[model samples]
Target: MSAVPISEHVALVTGGARGLGAHIVRAIAAHGGRVVINYRRSADAAHALADEIGDSALVFGADVTDKDAVGVMIDAAAEHFGAPVTTVVNNALPDYSFNGDGRSHADNLTWTELDAQLRGIVGGALNTIQAALPGMRAAGGGRMINIGTNLVQNPVVPYHDYTAAKAALLALTRTLSHDLGPDGITVNMVSGGLLRTTDASAATPDAVFDAIAAATPLRSVTTPAEFADAVLFFLSPWSRAVTGQNLVVDGGLVKN
Candidate 1:
């Protein structure tokens, strides 16, 4: 298989208005890919980011969990770029916080909470995948990189609902890898530990980050930029032969 350059792909990044999703957008643009930045409510941030990237970026608003909305967004992206989105980064996250002290334990975790997360994480991915299928098929090949969590593996904090949803995403990623392989679509995941700073992790105390960094081989908590790099790898031609795998980007914190 011939390797394709990042410049050859039009990419869509869900929740690309801020945080790690924003970083992923920047990374893809920096590497010469055109980006469709999808956001649900962070319109200002999304517009600001698209402005920063100039012509290489397009800002689209849609709730990833809404299949019809996602379909419309994908259609708009194709019309805007004059090409289908060949790379998708499933980075949209539902409202979540990483403050362990405030997290609900498994005993107190409600089914409603788990269901919400499943809809946001798994359902969102499913919507985007289905919406983008026709475009990907027409484009010949594509990349689908799902954002995951290291908590699914270690569960040190045991964020039961969040971990459970991401675990299911990983399962979905593998299943899609098999089903989509014939179509030349590679499905993979990039899981990160508590990133140093993101809206989701903003509530995390400094002490927790310090403690995590101290325990890591790199002596640092992963940054949004560092984690974004892994997403880039999965999107790049270098990963043409790679799929159905999860790359953990947590400063060697969780070696599995």
Candidate 2:
């Protein structure tokens, strides 16, 4: 595809300090967009990545679960960057609640744990979208991409809370797309299976990884960069007509 002209557009990515979020930030910068890297606790890493990327990047520290904090982060990003944010990638997740440890099933999971997970995933997206919408509407157009999971479609290794939250996010994406379409805003989702060896997934066992890979049609695990590519597509003009869709980037692991 021909390069998308993202020059002068400001993009905000939650959880942009490392892993998949970092890759998404880099990809946007590579495509000539200015990026605001948002993180909750990885301030050092966030600043380092922003510094490494030079003036086109800035780091904002905010817990996505907190609406007020998220608004401040978004406002600060717009003030620091020349353009108001016209693109948003909701990739920030709470520390993983699911490992292969088998502790995340419905039986063991408490309502409090489930509520926390849902709030982080669903509430975060809503907060950021609310903060960014006015700027986008004023600018005449924008894109919102919410990161989700393939497990919601095929729950092979069940993490009830995480999957349920992501499923809610997908539903939110569709509803928001319809609600905001008339105002020149688009909402979409990108879902992926277990990515290999990111800091978040480091505790996952080798055998579990192998089993997922074996079951995937591609017979391999995906990388953070590969997942970032899908996010980039949603930001590009090619996907202008696509909204309220969940694009799965799991190497055909869950064919729906």
Candidate 3:
């Protein structure tokens, strides 16, 4: 089989406004990939990011969990770029804080909370995959990259709801990879440990960050930019033979 060069394709990043998602958008653009920045609420931030990234980025507002909305968004994205959206980064997330403060332990974890995460992780991903698959089929092939968490492996913090949802997403990612392989669509995930500082991790105390960094072999916490760049690898030709794989990027915290 031949390799698919990502730099020539249009990449759409859901929740590509701030934090890791935003970093992914910037990285793809920097490498000459056209980008579609999708956001559910961060409209202004999304637009500003597109402006900063110059013509390589375009902004769109759509709820990834909503299948119809996602289809419309995909249509608009393709129309705007004058080409099919051949790359998708399912990075949208529900409102969450990784501060370990006010986080529900198993005792207080509610089904409602898990549902929200599921909607964002699993449901959102399902919608995007369904909406974009046809375009990929028409365009010859494509790539799908899902954002995941290292907690699913380490479970350092018992963030029951969020962790559970990501675990489910991992399962879905593998299943989709199998089903989409024949169509030339590669499905995979990029899981990262506690990023140093995103809206979710902003409240995480310095002591926790320091402790994590000290424990990791790299002696430093992961950053959004670093993680984002790793996501780009899957979309690149280098990973044409890799699918149904979870590439964890937490500084070797969990050796595969």
**Candidate with better TM-score, 2 vs 3:** 3
Question: Per-residue lDDT of 52-141 in model 1, one digit per residue for the tens?
Answer: 999999999999999999999999999999999998899998888766788898578999999999999999999999999999999888
- Badly placed stretches (over 4 Å) of model 3 are none
Q: Which numbered prediction scores highest in TM-score against the true structure?
A: 1
Better of 1 and 3 by lDDT: 1
**C-alpha-based local distance difference test score of model 1:** 0.92
Q: What's the TM-score of each model vs. the native? A: 0.97, 0.94, 0.97
Give model 1's TM-score versus the native structure: 0.97
Report the Cα lDDT for candidate 3. Answer: 0.89
lDDT of each: 0.92, 0.87, 0.89
- By lDDT, the best candidate is 1
Residues 22-76, candidate 3: write the lDDT tens digits. Answer: 8999999988999999999999999999889998788889989889999999999
Model 2 lDDT per residue over 12-104, tens place: 999999988999999999888899999999999999999889999988889988889988888898899856788999999977645557556
The backbone clash count of each candidate, in order, is 0, 0, 0
